[model samples]
Target: MEKPPSYGDSNELEQPGDDRALPPATLYVAGRFVHSDDPQAPPLYELSHSVGFLSDNDRVVRLERLDYTVRQYQGTPQVSTRARHVYDLTHPTLATSPTFAYHAEATSRRSLCSFGMESFRARTLSSAKGYRVHRAARGPDHRLVGREELFTAVPARDEAVVFEWYDARGGLLARETDNGELLSLLVSAEMGPRERDALVAAWILRVWWEMARDKGLGRWDDGAECP
Candidate 1:
């Protein structure tokens, strides 16, 4: 029931909220076989171009103390539903009412929203991944704050797209990936929430902070620390 202490040690944990400054969080997209809500189809796949939109597959539960449960989703196309939920191990009551709000869409080419993206922009920029940047879309009109950059990316094996947000430090501020594989493996054939397919993004600017604390070596644990 308890989350294994990250990777290395708990003492390395950064102060609350310190994660906001870290960059480039790595994302692993997989299906949601354990919680599929569909009556006939449960996610089941190992690798595929399956993912939900950023605005339709995500959820947020902000704690009263200013922390949060920021869960993003990732998956395969047929099972475009997955999630990443943040939890303050010390205080979990925060899951009740989230102060911040956002979502993503799974049916339409891995679309996304919030965390500084719009339905319009997300749809218009679905070709960011495998394709080279040809015609640049309109700039600086999204809802993101500070020196953040929105990137459209995709992994091999699927025809869908993924979204990522970055801060000035090149840290992966956030991400939204949906998986089609796990959706096929659901114990019960069922779909999740209405916005489930489209709402799977993550705010992880603090990924480094979490990793630093996790690996028990602040900053130094970064790849730069080795190479």
Candidate 2:
């Protein structure tokens, strides 16, 4: 595996080699679900479920599904699909489990505010690290929410990655090392998720990338994107 790019350099981003890219996968769909043709129409929660597929080369690799629902505020139903639970096609044992899940609930009586506030929790199932969960309470905007320790197999005597998430921020920050050598200074905060589905996907991909490296299935290359 090539050394991960220096995080200090703003131009360097972690990317995969062209020859060893993520199995040549293709996404099938990319859009939101809605109930009506009107621009202001809300999604029919009962019939609206986001679905997509990831295929490698020509073979299907996995299926993605997201169940959505409208959130209520002060007796008014919000058109925004604020609650989402994501699931990936997997073995029978894991079929019932969600690859990633996120849900936001109202915290205050003020519902029409431009920047409404709510508490959220996200969790993911990792093949390498079992299950990981993160929680954040209602707080000031841009405040530090929490930190996560990510274990990696980089042939280090004792090395691991630290990930930090912030409220109101759209990305995650990561610090990594290899064999006691500083492999990454600080991963791009800009790489974090911009939406609910993206937030879950980013975390899952981060874990899978390390797991692939540890298992010798792939090497961590600075030229490759995370998972």
Considering every candidate listed, which one attains the maximal lDDT?
Answer: 2
Local distance difference test, per candidate? 0.25, 0.27
TM-score against truth, every candidate: 0.22, 0.20
Tell me the tens digit of each residue's lDDT in model 2 across 31-84: 222122233433322112222111111111121223345778999986443332
lDDT of 1 by residue, 71-178 (tens): 545643332333322221111122543222221111121122223221222334463222111111222442213123333222223334234433323343233333
What is the RMSD of candidate 1? 19.8
Global fold similarity of model 1 (TM-score): 0.22
Which 10-residue window of candidate 1 scores lowest in summed lDDT?
218-227
How does residue 30 of candidate 1 score in lDDT? 29
After superposition on all C-alphas, the RMSD of every candidate to the true structure, in Å, is 19.8, 21.1
Cα displacement (Å) at residue 92, model 1: 22
